[model samples]
Target: MSFKNYAFYDKIMLSKPVTVKGLTFISVVGITIQAYGKYGVFLWSTITPKALIVVDSSGDISFYQISNDTATSELLESITLLFAEE
Candidate 1:
């Protein structure tokens, strides 16, 4: 077999998803979002500045400062820092 075939076979062997320690963040401005997930219908619109939006699996649109936080204080602090710059 060629190198390409060997690589494909290796990927197929590890098709399961694994959890890695990390965080994910998405930022967008002046754009609308439509989210469809296992929860419900969620929508968001950002026509202003400092718009932090999060759409979960339940389809809920909420305005938040920080994206991922371990505690409420952390979230608040992040949000505070976020708008503090702009």
Candidate 2:
């Protein structure tokens, strides 16, 4: 028996997460999203610049922005989200 034989030593811990697909999201107001899956809709936020993204059955995607609590479609390639303070 040795220290290197410990069960915890068998696995390597990652300093950060690794994501090959979907998107990582975070925002102010204590919201943190690790991953967004494929298909269906992505409910962004209810605050300023409220946004929504819908993915159809065939993989067609759409982006929408909210104004006066109404959602309006927009053309977007990608979007960025803020991270919480460490």
**Model 2 C-alpha lDDT per residue in residues 1-86, reported as the tens digit of each score:** 21221121111111232223553222212122232334443433222334444555455655445334332311121222112211
lDDT value, residue 72 of candidate 1: 44
Residue 46, candidate 2: alpha-carbon lDDT: 22
Best by lDDT: 1
Q: How many clashes (backbone N, Cα, C below 3 Å) per candidate?
A: 2, 0
Measured over all alpha carbons after superposition, the RMSD of each candidate to the real structure, in angstroms, is: 20.0, 18.9
Measured against the true structure, the TM-scores of the candidates, in listed sequence, are 0.22, 0.26
Root-mean-square deviation of Cα positions for candidate 2 versus the true structure, in angstroms: 18.9
lDDT of each: 0.36, 0.30
TM-score of 2: 0.26
True-vs-predicted CA distance for residue 60, candidate 1, Å: 18
Top TM-score prediction, candidate number: 2
